[model samples]
Target chain A: MRFRIRFAQQVVGFFILAALATLVVVLILMGLNQRWFDRGYSFYSRFQSADGLTPGMPIHLRGFEIGKVTSVDLNSNNRVNVVLQIYSEYYDKIKPNSVLELEQGTFGIGGGLNLLPGKNLLPPMEPDSFLPSTDTLLGKNLLAQGLVDQPANNDQMSAILAEVQTTLSGVNLLLNNVNSAIDGTSNNQLTGLLQGVNATLRSLDSVLTESAHGLVPNLSAITANLAKLSAQLQDPKGLIPKLLDPKGSLATILNDNNQLYNEVQSILDQVNQTLVQVRGLTQYLNQSTPQITGVIEDTRTTLKKADDVMTGLANNPLLKGGIPEKKPQNATFHDLRDEDF
Target chain B: MTERKPNLFERVGATTFDLFHNTFYAFGFFWNVLGETFRFRSRSRVSTQVLVMQILFTGVNALFIITLIAVSLGTVIIFYGNQITTLVSTNFVYTILITVITRELGPLLTAFIVMARSGVAIATEISSMVVTHEIEAYLAVGINPISYLVVPRFLGVTLSMVALNLYFNLSGLAASYLVAQFFHPIPANEYFGQLMTQLTPTAVASSVVKSLAFGFVISMVSTLNGFRAQQSTTEIPIIVIRAVGQGFALLIVVNILITLVFPR
Candidate 1:
């Protein structure tokens, strides 16, 4: 009985030990699975707003999850500060200029922080150092449109409202100016000036019509006369052709050794001298005409005025006393005596 | 006069009372066994002959059926897995296989097999012992029947379950690879490498934990139900049937609970 019991005890012990060993092995394997012994470096990122980001949300680099968010806190600057722990194996890949962006996935699923590595080959960032946070264009647009909450003062909407108010005021001022210009006194003056211009244009049109009517027949007569003269000149046996022909009488006379040509040249010179004298006389007449007319008109006016004065004296006898007598100059007599001496 | 019907409150009270009573009794039995097993100074109470007998009956005897079912299931999984591979990366196929087999199917199928094959045997054997007054004989001889009878079977079934589950996983994965070879024709080394790459320690640990828990429930429920048999010889078969049913139900519930707690 004792031997049998001992054997049973061994069997039970073996089974229990095997199970415990299996559990221990599983624990070790789990530790390996989690990379529990692997060295990890910590870093942080600062976001303006947390959005949907939470602790334990994975941080991915190039689509691979290298770490997880360890903590999310509000910093002094009122930004969300997220701390992360990445495995040391990927330390070299993280540059100092790396930016962490909170990317939202499609269909509202799988949103997380993605690290966008910088192009510069700077040294890896120190552990616990803060990485810069970038707001995606979607996030910025959403914030601008007031679809997302702003962590700080909402200045975008206020600025837009101020601009809109300024624009409205400007439009109001423009409308007022337009109204004043439309209703001011200058508008009536413009209408009157336009009417006067229209009347002047009508008179000018009548004058031009009368001038055109009177000039048309004369111009037609002149043209017909010119045409007749041109026809005569164009005739082969015309007098102008006969005179200008090289073998004609005028041509012979106008030749180099002809007496008649010299006489004709002397006559033409005399005629040119007469024309010069006439041109001078006409210029003198043109210069003196306006002055002569003015003098004559003045003398006539003075005579008429004297006649009027005499008539007035004749009509009223008291007016003669009011007229001043002509005074003789004493200096004239003395001067005449000295001259005579 | 018509029979008086029990009120809703009385019915509810009675049901609640029965539930608590059964729960507490099962918990008490489980606790006692745990305590007795831990009492290392009383190691003589467990018999080696009986432990070996139980392991042989439960573990060795159930191997052929477990292999048959596991291989067939593996073949079906691989046949469908070939279809899935076309849609996803081969790595994703490994992930799906590991998630299905290691996380859910392996421990469950092994538990069901042990329950159906050995659970009824343990319950009926214990019930027969009870009916023949063998337990009374043990008590008269100043031996605790629990230590002599229950402890060996408990250790045997639990340990055997864990071992059988490991075997099931190996055979299942191997047979699946064989079946997959006919369709996809992947090299064995590369296939295993891909599987190992996707396999995680947590998945294996969860599988182990699930099997451990399942084994505990099956052994405890079956042994408890067996010991519930009273003086009637006819009660043995009823107790055995109840043990099988309750063991299966408990294992499935435990599997679901474990899965919920440890999702991939």
Candidate 2:
């Protein structure tokens, strides 16, 4: 039993020693993983803003991370002064005239700082030296002089976002134009004014049907026929052929210039007078009813439908109802002077 | 006038006072033991031998069960905690593992186990010696029974408890990494790197302080209850039971107090 006790004490001793060993091993591993012993060379740069730039952000050279940011502060000039800690192993890449660029993240993704190396073939800068950033005036002059090797921007996400922004702006302008065009009150478009003319014509057509007993039964067909006649006259095979032939009636009339010219001038004068009267009539009708579906380019077809519907309501007295008298809502009178009378 | 029997309020008041008195006495005993621990090297080889035996019984004897329980707990926590906290962050399991096994559960569970195993045995042994006149024999020889008997067990139990808790944390954390393999398939470097990152200094300090406080509480409660034994042999079993119960209560209370006072 005593021998067993002695062996047990040995085991207990080993247990404690082993636990201590584990603790020491873990601490060492942690130190290595967290880079506790690595030497850092310091450099400073300035930026316009501190957005998306923070201490401990990885600084990439070309495409690989070679250092980290140490401190970020605002100088007296209201500019962001960022201090970088480049690892001693990569300190050779940090030559004089090197520049820094702060890349902002797109749509909440993280972005990193990029270091543009010097192109002067100079030696590495010493620690605690000043480095210029792309935002600084000196950095811009260095870039203009080709002293720094600024790589081509290969970020495709920013280009795609810019295209999306431009497309959204064009769509917004189109929507505003469309909104103002069809909003009715402020509209001064060709279709808007022509619609008011159509409304006036419709009222005149209604009144003509109601007053006339045996006039045109379908003004819509008359208007269509008139449009067709004008289109035919403009065709080469129609009026042109007749006028150009020497034996044609038009040619004969043209041969007798004085009488025919006098008659044609009188007809043109009558047509001009008729047009002016129609304009005055249209204006008078527009005052009574204030909307329009005018007999314009596309509305000509709409006016035909309007004439058909208008003729019915105008010619049929039984279908039209008379206006009824409106009764007063507040009929009670509590006036003492009127009651005494 | 006839004296009146104490009412329920007075009975409760007296019991509360007794409980507080016992608590104060136990703390005083802890202070005495701490003072004697410094001078324990001046004691005879018998006390040192007793200390070695105490360590052998408390720490080495309890290793197998502690390892088994730790591995089982670690495996369950990793398998479940990984799946649950994955909704928040993929690396959240490391924080959970460190918190449960190191900062909170590691010290707490080991203290409970040590109290259950060593505490009852210590109380029974000391009380039995008292009933058998062995304590009187030490006193008659001009030897302080405290330095010769109780001090060794006190130091032994406290040291064993702290060592056992550390061993528990090491075994439990290692087991969790192994169990995490079935789920995450992480490299050892990355696994331990992330775990070590989450295991901050505040957490390690919390675990150590709790372990020390609970070790003292368990040893003090058990030895105090043991010395309360009387001449009758029947008092041995009673004091031993009281020692186990008191040790458990004090361990839990001290664990809560340390956790509240310190940051984890």
Cα lDDT, all candidates: 0.77, 0.82
Question: What proportion of the real contacts between chains A and B does each prediction keep?
Answer: 0.04, 0.38
lDDT of 1 by residue, A1-341 (tens): 55534464465456456646755754565565445687689998777788778886767776666777889999887878789888777878677556777856433344577776655667888888867666545434433454322233223345678899999999998777556555553455555666677899999999999999999999999999999999999999997889889999867766867677678889999999999999999999899999989999999999999999888886786775766777976663455446754
Candidate 2 colliding pairs: A195-A292, A196-A292, A198-A294
Worst 10 residues of 1 chain A by lDDT: A147-156
Off by over 4 Å in 1: A1-33, A46-82, A99-116, A132-341, B1-24, B67-95, B173-205
The lDDT leader among the candidates is 2
Could you tally the backbone clashes for each prediction?
A: 2, 3
Error of 2 at A143 (Å): 16
TM-score of chain A of each: 0.35, 0.40
Q: For residues B188-240, write the lDDT of model 2, one tens digit per residue.
A: 87788878756776777888888878877777778888889889988988898
